[model samples]
Target chain A: MVEPVLDVKGLEKSFGALKATNGASLDLRPGEIHALIGPNGAGKSTLINQISGALAPDAGSIRFLGTDITMLDTARRARMGLARTFQISSLAQEFSALRNVMLAVQARQGTSLRFFRPVASDVSLTEPAMRMLSRVGLADRANVPAAALSHGERRQLEIAVALAMEPKAFLLDEPMAGMGPEGSKALTGFLDGLRREAPILLVEHDMDAVFALADRVSVLVYGRIIATGSVSEIRNDPEVRRAYLGEPA
Target chain B: MGARETTVNVLLVLLLPAVALTALFIGEAFYITLATRIAILALAAVGLNIALGLGGLVSFGHAAFFGLGGYVAGVLATHAFNMEPVAFGLPGTTAMPAIWLVAILLCGLVALPIGLVSLRTSGVYFIMITLAFAQMIYYFAISWPAYGGEDGLSLSMRNGFPGLNTAKPFPYFVVVFVLLLAGLLLFHRLRASRFGAALEAARQNPARLAAIGISPFAIRLVAFVLSAMITGLAGALFADLNRFVSPSMLSWHMSGELIVLIILGGKNRLFGPLAGAALYVLFEYALGGLTERWQLFLGLVLLAVVFFARGGLIGLLAGRPRHG
Candidate 1:
């Protein structure tokens, strides 16, 4: 079998007395979308935060492309090609959408110490940024400030920013939250093709999109991965239905 | 900037030199000195604007840098006057270039540790820590007897420039005005650079900036150091302009005045400091002529700026800035 692009082993975290993630293990293979689905209060965001280096895990080893990244800071991880998007659409609100993507592109290009040239006229930064915006179907909204963009457009801008990182793996936390049906469908299609560029570890709630697009699925409940399998297998698992699918045992 | 702002900025830039040169043609040396004071103070506030305005790092300790620059000039001038080495047998010079260079370098060096400690906390904590650092420097200056202690240091003569007689008010004013233009130009260039993009991003959303792979702390520290260097240069000039250096340059009131200058003109506008300094000096002149309690009126004006003019003078004249 192919080596996993991202591997988490025996992850654990706790807040005071409550354990948010307990002995959870998962991996994302190259060219595949691994959907992590769970109910509310199931520690999904906590686990994602640990993986993204926003929170320190109590116990875990996360290996990205055969390198241990458990001790790295968020910015270092991002510079090393671990791109992520916030669950609640975090962006430079005062910046234009194109400028937002341009920042990511500039980060990917290396040090931001260049002090004389105007970023507005730098084609090297702008061309690639414009391309990423176009790829996310936000070309027309490039000049609009991130604060002025609609909810769905901001989400699209987030994805465009992540794309600018040229990341090896994407830790996307709830990319579908607050998106309307039409927007969700369009994004589901976009994400379908994005797996070829970099494998995505997707944390999401939209069941239809998850079922239609996920190559494999993992069911998490109460800080544990109770089941992991192909979509059809996960859908039919008796314990998964009882614990997360809300079906009576 | 829009065309309207650009035009306003041009006029603002021109107004200072116009008034100063008009004073010169009419043989009014007092107004030329007043214009020099406005330019030097504006240069100092321009430095603070980099940290406070663009980077949103409200530093209440910039007077430490301003005073450091002043002391550099005072000490060097004293050593040169007495024909003695400053330290480690290093001889001092009365050259303006050398004084400014030492002042800028010393301020940047001092700001590094201060920024490292202060940048760790933000909001009121950041403000308090920076203020505490400035106060420490102020007290140190007061207790250091070699520099005349609380009595302050005095220059027997104004420092020398390469091509011109700096003792004359108009020639000195020209040099200061040129330096002010340089400071404004640097601010403009930095605001348009990649580092500036990251700096503003750090100000607006540090987490978002970090997620994109830039450390906000690092950006802020750099801005802080740069701000100090510029402010320190102004301090050196200020010492030459007054031909004296005192602990009062490092006082908390000086820090507050720098902040007030930025707020009165506009927080982030290019000509904000210049406008604010001009307005402040004019108020001091016009109001002092009318009454001994000029500060009361200045306080009321500041209040109106804070409440009614949200972005300060430039904001009212130019409208809101188009981009962050």
Candidate 2:
């Protein structure tokens, strides 16, 4: 088995009386495609948030690449090769699509305090961003403002930005949440290409895409993991079917 | 962003100096003085833009640092002219460069505390806290009897510039005009820097900025202080130009006017403050001459601009920004 790049044990979170996440645990091995699927309000986003250091879990220890990163801030976590995409697209809309990726590259490469020269002229930052954009099929739309991009294109741009970080693991929160059939197929192909390099923790509602791509599937219901196994095992499990699949086995 | 936008930017920067030179030549000493005031005030606005425009920190108490800069210049000149010692028995100097440095340092120091506290909160709370701090300083200035209290201090002669007669309106205007240009250039450079990008990112998407390894609070606080220092330098020039320093400079109204200048010109543009200041002074001169309640007209115009002109004069002139 591939050594785990991400390990979460006894992760718990609550909002007042509501337990949003309860003793949830997950393991994402290197170069593995892990799909976390559930209906609405399944705490999948919350789990990603904790691993990405956006939220502090109530009771849990998160280890990334053998380092205890539970106390790190989101940016620090990102710098440590952990990248994530927001459920709702959060990009610098006014800036060009290329500029967004360039900024991510700038964050990783050198001191961002370089003020004397124009950033666009800097080959170091722009080149890597361009390469990333091309990888995500957005090289042609590089100069267009992110606000002008289509929803699907914006999702592609978000992935491009994540790629600029050169991360070891990605917490992609519904990359195909609002995508159409064509968009979904494109994103799935993109994910398949990326799966040979870094591990992807995909939180998705699209079971078809999940079953198609996920090497290991984890079923979450009411903030608890009901089952975790291979696609066939999850599809055949009586408990998973009764609690989630809602189909007679 | 393109050759056309670049050409427009060049024309605007070049146009201000042309108008400033015309004002020096064709105008009376009074109008020349008015132009000087506009230029200096625009420089202050440019300073505020470093934070407000680029960093997205709307600091309401910038007047405190501005007034403090003016006081530093005024107080130092008063002591030097008299050949006496200041509060700590430190003899003052009449050198313009030294005064600017002192003003910048003092304002930066003062801004550190204000920024540290204000940065703890955000949105409405940040605005209110900064305003409250400025009021605190304004009240302090009004109550303090040492420098003339509310009466204000007047310089018998303008502070000396190294090789020129600063007492003459045109020469004095030239001095301030050059400083304003230099300040604008510095701002252009700062806005294009990596730190500037991070600061802007912090404003636009703080969560993402943090995810990228930059702390929003620290970035904003540093920007706030640097911004305050620049505005403070402009304020010192303002006092020297008028040969006067008063509590009015520190008033909350003055702070509001500075922000008004930024909005009027267009936030984040290179020459937005200059254009805004020129318009404001022109409006004040033209409207005040025509009506007794000129401020009422100005208020109405401002309202119209805020409602309709989303990007201000620069927006009207240059169009939407193409670059981040």
Candidate 3:
């Protein structure tokens, strides 16, 4: 069996009386896209937050690259090559698109403490940043501020920033949330090939993208993984069809 | 920077020294003193801008550092004049360079703990905590009779600078002008550096910065300490200018004034503090000559700027910034 790139076991979270994540366990293997789909308020975001170290799980253990990262903070996890994108587009709005991506590149280089040289003139940061921007098809818009980018363009920029992290594993939460149909189709195609770079744990509402790109699918309902299997098995599973697909059993 | 801003910055850089030198040549010593005052205040505000403008950490107690710097100079100069050892049997020296070095190091030391506690909370809480820290220092300075307490300490003469005679208003103004230029240069370099990129990003979205593996707290703390050091240096110069150091230097009003200077010139803009200081001093001079209640008019102008000219003087002159 392939050693998983990321492993989460028995994750649990509670907000007051509501259980946000309840005994959830999942993992992502190398060179495969793992799509996690659930209805709204099924605690998908909470689970992602816990795995990414944004929120601490009440009870759980997460191992990434075979190291126990359950107690790490978000920045520490990121430095260890765990990169994630926000469901909401969060970026340095005033920074140029190239600069935004360069932030990730700079972080990856661990030279954020370098205080004297001009960042704009640093080819070590700019070259890789520009390459990521071109890959995301935002090369021409590199000089434009993130705030000025189109909605679809901003989503692409977010991915570009994440790509600049050189992540070992990607936890992309709702990457297609605000993208248009055409944008979604294009990004689905892009994400399909991105698995070659790093294994992805994708949380998406776009079922077509999920089904089209996922090597495996996990149906999460009310903070629990009801089923994990290949796309065909998840599509035909009676429990998944009834609870998530909203089909009569 | 755009051509327009470059031109404006050049003009600002030239205007102060030009006016002061002209005053020197023409024997208008009072104008030279006024120019010195503007330069010192602007330098202090420039220090505050690093934290408040770039890092978006609104520190309301920067006067703590400013006054700390002042007291360093005052205490050292007093001990030197009395020929007494200033603690640890270390002889006090009136050298400007040595005083500034001690002031900068002490302020950085003080800022570390203050920033460690204050950066934990942001927005109004951050402001209140910083203000509280400054007020604590202010009261301590008042109650501590060893350094004159509320009566304040005074230097018998302006502190010494190597080679140059700082006793003359013009030479002293020259020293201050050079330091102001250095401060602006530091601000420009820091604003363009990789650390600056992270600081600005931390300001815009700390979560995004953290997601990319940068700790916002670390960035903010560094910025805060650096800011305090710059402000502290300015305080040393300010005390030498007046030959006096008092708790009033650490007062909350002084803190508020530093922030006001930044806003009046233009927050975050290079030369914002200088422009604001020039305007503030001009108001003080022009208004003080006319009426005792001049602050009323200053208040109105500040209101107008806050209401109508959100960008302050530089924004009005150079136009809206190309990038935020």
Candidate 4:
């Protein structure tokens, strides 16, 4: 078997008296979309934060591409090809969508210290940013401010931004969280197409989409992974139903 | 279409000095002198704009860099005239380039420490910390007796500029006008660079910037230092133009005025600072001559603009901002 692209063992985090994550562990292999399903306060976002270097874990190790990345900062992790999408839509509201993506592309390309040259006029940045926007069906909205996009469109833009990084894996925090039925359907198709490109660690509450898209499903309750297996296996587990599924099989 | 835009942009830049010259030749008076002041002040405001407008760093202590730059020129010339060496046994030089270099270096050095400490917090804290640091410098300048303290130092003659006589009004105006143009051009170029985009991104969503392989704090610090350096250069020129340097240069009021210029013209626009400075000086000239309580009117106008006009003069004239 190929070595896991991401390996987390006994990762832990706490907020004073409240434990957010406790001995949480996950492993994602290359070209696999792993779904992390849990109730509110299940520590899914905290796990993603620790893994993405947004938050330092209290204990355990996080390894990416066979190197320990537990001590690295968020930017270092991103430079190492780890990318994340915020749970809330956080975008450069004033900038055009094209400019926003170009910013991400600019970071991966080279030093931004080249004074006396107009970066916006450069084909190198604009071309790829345009292509990324088109990929997410936002090509027409390229010139529009990011704040003007519809809720679903902004979510798609977030994905496009992550794609610009050419990340090894995407830690998406609820890409479908606030979407309507049509938006969810569109995003489901988008993710289905994206799965062929890279591994994704998806923290989502949409059960239907999780069952539909997840290559491997993990059930989390109170920050700990209670069950991890195929859909059928997870469905058949009695403890998972009472604790997470909230119903007997 | 893009080629057309690039050409228009270049042409627009070239047109400014031409317009400035016409203003100098046609409107000949102390008003021409007033115009010169506006031009130099605009240069200073433009420098501050890079940090405040583009980088989202509201530095209230920028006046400190401004004052330091002016002091560099004033002190150097004063010592050179007296044939005395400045501190550390360095002989004073009347050269403008050397003065500018020293000013840039000094401002950058001071900005580094200030940025390092201030960058630890952002938003209101950043504003207050920068303002506080500026006030500290202002107080220090007031207390320091070596440079005439609150009384300030005066330059009887203009410092040497190799090709031109620096004493003549029209020639001096030309020199300052050219420098102002250069500052404006440099600002435009800097705004369009990759570092600029990163700085803008840092302003928008720092967390997102961090997730894109850049430390927002580091980016902001670099921008802050560069911004201070540019503003310092303008300050040096400002001192040379007036042939005076004093604690007023370091005042918190000067810092507020710098911000006022940007906001009055338009924030983040290429010509915003220029337009703002022009209007401010004109208002002061016109209002000071007309009424004693002109500042009260100025205050009322400023409040109205802030409340009603989100974009300043440049925005009204140039239309909406093209960039984020």
Candidate 5:
């Protein structure tokens, strides 16, 4: 059997007395979008942070491509191909969209330490950065600053930056948040195509995108997985309907 | 670039050469010395600008590196004069290049620990930790008696520069000018390079930098060390300029002045330090000539810059920033 791209087993994290992520275990096989869904305060982000190595797990381990990465730092995890996007838009606001993506390209190329070459005119960095932007439908906005780009455009640019990394697996935190219907639909299409490049551990509040793209879905309630199965199973799960979907089973 | 930035860039390019020409044409040693002072101060501030302006580090311990550089020059020149070998049995030399090498290495060595510790904290904590480190070194210099202790040390004559009579103010000023331009070019090139991109990215959003697989701590530390090296070299020139080195070189006020020059010029603009240093030196010169209480006017001017001229002299003179 091929190893999962990302595997979390018995993960536990807390804030003082609050159990933020409790015994959460999941896996993402190659070419699959494993959607993690929960209501407010369900610790979805906390779980994602632990897997990305931003926050430490109180117990349990995260294995990426069969290597334990529970104690690794964020940069190390990213270099090991566990790429993530923040719930909030995290970008070098002062840098142009092209420059922002070029930063990721430079990281991928391992040339960020090179000080003499002008990054702007470097075709090696720019060409690939432009390609990432074009893939996200942001080729026209390449020269605009990240801060200057609109909300949807920034979202697209974020994916472009992540794509520039050529990630082995993706950890997306609410990638559909604040996105309009058209943006969400387009992103769903993009993400569907993205699963072929690398598996994704998706934590999103947008159920439509989740159901449309997720090959499997897991429901989280009060920091523990209540159910893990197909989209119809999660939709029919009685407790999930009461606690999350606000409906009678 | 905006029309204003282009104009500022043109003026920045012209100002130094114009100063050199006017001083030589007039044949005044005082003017030549003043120009040299500007170049050295600009060079030092350029170093501080890498951290404060570009990297957004706001380091207050840079004086430690600067003073260390000045002392390297003073101590080496003194040892060379006395025909005494330094503690390691290494013969001391008055060669400018050799002194610069030692100063840079010394600054790097010292800045490593300081950067390691200080980079752990950020914002006000980072500022205070750096300031505290500078004060520790400052107080140490005050009590070290081997180098004249509190009294300070002086070189018998200005240090030697290869093929140049450095004792002459014009020749020394030219050497300092060339170095100042080189420093500026370095700053210009670096801010547009990959390293600069990472440093700036670290400044803007460190988490984002990590997500892109670059460690912010490593980039900031490299920037801090490089900043120290630049300032250290400038400090060596400053010691030669005065034919003296003292604890005053390491004072907290010196650290404050370095930051002031960067802010007064404009943070993150290429030539902001040079423009800011020019304005500051001119203020000190003209204001001191007018009154002993020029500090009041200087304070008022700095206040105006802080309140209204957020971009400093460069920002006001230049148009809006194109990228950030």
Candidate 6:
């Protein structure tokens, strides 16, 4: 069997009496869209946070490319090619869209430590950053500050930033949130093609986009993986139906 | 970038040196001394602006570094005067370059730990912790009897600068003015660099900074240490200007005034500290000459500026906050 690019095993976390994640195990193979689906407050985001190193699991082992990364910092994990985006918009609001993406490009190129040269005029940094921006269809709005961008545009900018990371895998949490249907359709198409670049562990609620894009689906209920299968099988599973899909068992 | 901002900057860069030179030509040593104060204070505020304006780290412990710089100058000047061999068997020298090197190194050494500890907490907690650490240093200065202690130490003469008679106010002002200009140019370069972009981004959203594969803690820490070194250098100049080193340099009021200098001119503007320092010194000279109770008038003026002018004097003039 091919080794998964991102592997998590027996992960667990608790806040007082509540278990945010309970022995959750999953693996993301290269170039596959593995969608994680759950009802609201089912700890999908919590699990993503733990996987992304934003929140540490109380007990678990996460191996990326076969190296254990459970104790690594979020930035270190990102540097190692594990990229992520927040569910809520987390961006440098005051920065223009081009500059925001340029930061990611600078980080990736290891040029952020160079203090003398102007990043604005550096063709090396701006060229790739602009390419990433264009990928998200934000080519024209590159100079607008992130705070001033419409909600859909901010979401697009986040994708541009992530793309600039040159990631080994992507952990996108609710990338479709706050996006109108047209924007959703556009991004859904983009993410579909993006999965070919790197495997994606997609945590999302929009079932239409999820079902359309996922190679396989895992139904998470109360932090446990209740079922994992191809999209249609998981969609028709009785456990997912009663516990999550709000259908009679 | 606006026409008004460019004109204001031209005036700011020109007026002080012009006035200082004119005063020197008129043979008024007192006015030259005042200009030196502005240059030194502006230099100190420029250092604080790196952390405060760009990185958005409001370091209240900056006075600690400033005072440390002053003390470095004082202790070395004292040891050199007494012909005492100091630690590491290196005899103290009254050389400006030597004193500046020692001051910057010592400030960096102290700032590393202070920044490491304080940067772990942010907002008001960070502010209080930095202030508390500075106060600790202040108390230590008062109690350390080997130096002048509570009364402070006085230099026998100004530290020597090679190829210049620094005892003369005009030449001394030239030294300070040149250093301050160099610092401003460096600040401009740093603000436009890649490091600066990440630092500013960290201030806006640390999580996003991390997501982009840069550690916010590391960025802010570097900025803090650099800020300390700059302020420490200014402190060295300030001690030389007055030919005195005291605990007051380490006081919270000193820290507050440094921040006020940044704010009064405009927070984060490259010329904000210079503008604020010029205005502050002007207020001190003008209002101080008029009445004994000038601080009250200064307070009222400051209140009007803070309440009505959110971006500060530069913001009032420049049509926008340049650095924010």
RMSD of every candidate to native, in Å, equals: 1.2, 2.2, 1.0, 2.9, 1.2, 1.3
Q: Enumerate residue pairs that collide in model 4.
A: none
TM-score of chain A of each: 0.99, 0.97, 0.99, 0.97, 0.97, 0.99
iRMSD in angstroms, per model: 1.2, 1.5, 1.3, 1.4, 1.2, 1.8
Preferred candidate (lDDT higher): 4 or 6: 6
Tell me the tens digit of each residue's lDDT in model 3 across B152-211.
Answer: 998899999999999999999999999999999999989899999999999999999999
What is the RMSD of candidate 6?
1.3
Deviation from native of the Cα of residue A138 in model 1, angstroms: 0.8
Q: Model 4 misses residue A45 by how many Å?
A: 1.6
Clashes of each: 0, 2, 0, 0, 1, 0
Tens digit of lDDT per residue, candidate 6, span B1-324?
567888988899898788888898898889989989998999999999999999999999899999999999999999999999778888988999999999999999999999999999999999999999999999999999999999999999999999999999988899999999989988888889999999999989999999878999999999999999999999999999999999999999999999989989888788899999999999999999999898788788789889998678888998774332
Clashing pairs in 1: none
For candidate 4, what is the DockQ-based docking class? medium
Q: Higher TM-score: candidate 1 or 2?
A: 1
How do the residues B180-292 of candidate 5 rate in per-residue lDDT, one tens digit apiece? 98998899888889999999999999999998899999999999999999999999999999988999899899999888888888988887888888988999999999999
Q: Could you tell me which 10 consecutive residues in candidate 3 chain B have the lowest summed lDDT?
A: B315-324
Model 5 TM-score, 2 decimals? 0.98
For each candidate, what is the lDDT? 0.94, 0.86, 0.95, 0.85, 0.91, 0.92
Range of the 10 consecutive residues with the lowest summed lDDT in candidate 1 chain A: A109-118
Please identify model 5 stretches exceeding 4 Å from their true place: B1-3
Mark the 10 consecutive residues where model 4 chain B has the least summed lDDT. Answer: B1-10
Q: Estimate each model's TM-score.
A: 0.98, 0.94, 0.99, 0.93, 0.98, 0.98
Using DockQ as the measure, what is the rank order of every candidate, best first? 5, 3, 1, 6, 4, 2
lDDT of 4 by residue, B201-309 (tens): 8887889889978888888888899888888988898898889999899998999999998998888777778778877887898898899888787788788769877
Docking tier of model 5: it is medium
Q: Give candidate 6's error at residue B280 in angstroms.
A: 1.4
DockQ per model, Cα: 0.76, 0.60, 0.78, 0.67, 0.79, 0.71
User: Candidate 1's residue-wise lDDT over B155-200, tens digit each?
Assistant: 9989989999999998899999999999999999999999889999
